[model samples]
Target: MELLFIERISTEQLEDLHRISVHTFRSNYGHLNTPENLQQHINQHLSKERLKTELEHPEMRFFFAWVDGKVVGYSKLNTGQGQTEDYGEDQLEIERIYVLEEYQGNGYGGALIQHAEQQAKTLGKSNIWLGVWEKNPRAIAFYEHIGFRKIGTHTFQVGQDPQTDWVMRLSL
Candidate 1:
């Protein structure tokens, strides 16, 4: 495997962001969801326009992981008010950390989490948190392995379907 490198993504890379976001989401969850629901979720949340707006947020940062010049994963980090939930000023959110299915186990996701932690620490944050689908045991286990503890639950929408997400936090 080629060594992976991480770079901050700029607005000029909106197309790449959109493509990877949608593709990774679909690859990860499409089989478990109805096609209609998957399409609706992608159209609503992962559109290029929405991504561009998100990229412009002052408190949100995006990063892409590349291996041998190919983009294989991405992460979104939010601080201050850009966080999906109000976890206070000392807390940062790992809003999204996704790797392409083919790239799993390559350490990109773990690297992204480490990056998030470093960002939070540099910003004087004491904690980093994220919501993982309750049904995703793999993600939950990964978080646990990384020292995250379940703190609460939140409601997340996948198209029109209501789902539960476990909020996990790691104190830095």
Candidate 2:
């Protein structure tokens, strides 16, 4: 197996970040949503400008997963005020984690979560959490297999659609 390398992304890599963000997201969720809704969601949330701003945020971090010099996945981690919900100072939120469809079942997702765990521990956070769309059973199962437990539910907006997400947490 090829080694999967994960590295923190910088503001200078905004274009690569934006490209993968939109591609992975649309590939994962586009089939389940209308074109208009998908477009709206991408424009509002994954726009280059928005991503650039986020890349510069002190409390937020983005990481790219690379295999043989090719990017295959990415994750977004948040702490402090950057978190969508205030889970308190001792928790780190994994706002996003997406692996390209071709890379599914290859252990990249687990590696990303492991990287997130290391980051959380480095930040002195006692727990790590995330909101997974209720519709994505595969992802929910993956998180559960990694010892995350469902703690609650939250509404995640994608365009005008209000989607339900299960809040899952793992204590470090």
Candidate 3:
């Protein structure tokens, strides 16, 4: 494993962003969902146009994890009005954090979460939160290992399928 570096994504990297987002998302969730649902979710949330709009949002931030000059993962953070839920002004929401299948267990996911925490602190946030799918025990364990606690639950729609997500939070 080469040194992992995280870069704040710029609008010029829209194509790279879109590529990684779709690939990682499908790789992670495709087998667990119907083909129609998976494709619909990708089209609705990971499309180039949607990614570009998110990249341009003032309260939203995107970061890419790079190793040996290749992007291996990415994370998306939201503050204020950009947050999916109203966790309040002092909190930052990690809307997405994903590492490619081949790159898992190499600490890239933890690095991405650390990056999010630093960003949240920089923005004067006291807490950082995210929604993790209830079925993903690996993710739930990972977040728990990092000191995040399940504070609530919410419905996360992947296409037309409604799924339960554990709302986890960590106080800075």
lDDT of 3 by residue, 31-91 (tens): 9999999999999999999999999999999999999998999999999999999999999
Clashes of each: 0, 0, 0
Q: Model 2 — which ten-residue stretch has the worst lDDT?
A: 1-10
Better of 1 and 2 by lDDT: 2
Candidate 2, lDDT over the whole model: 0.95
* Predictions in order: lDDT: 0.93, 0.95, 0.95
Candidate 3 regions exceeding 4 Å error are none
Instruction: Tell me the tens digit of each residue's lDDT in model 2 across 1-172.
Output: 4799999999989999999999998999999998988999999999999999999999999999999999999999999999999999999999999998898889999999999999999999999999999999989999999999999999999888999999999999
Query: Candidate 3 — worst ten consecutive residues by lDDT sum?
Result: 19-28
Question: What is the full ranking by TM-score, best candidate first?
Answer: 2, 3, 1
The local lDDT score (0 to 100) that residue 87 gets in candidate 2 is 92
lDDT of 1 by residue, 1-172 (tens): 5787889899999999999999999998998888988899898889998899999999999999999899989999999989999999999999899999889997788988988898899999999999999999999999999999999999988888888999999999
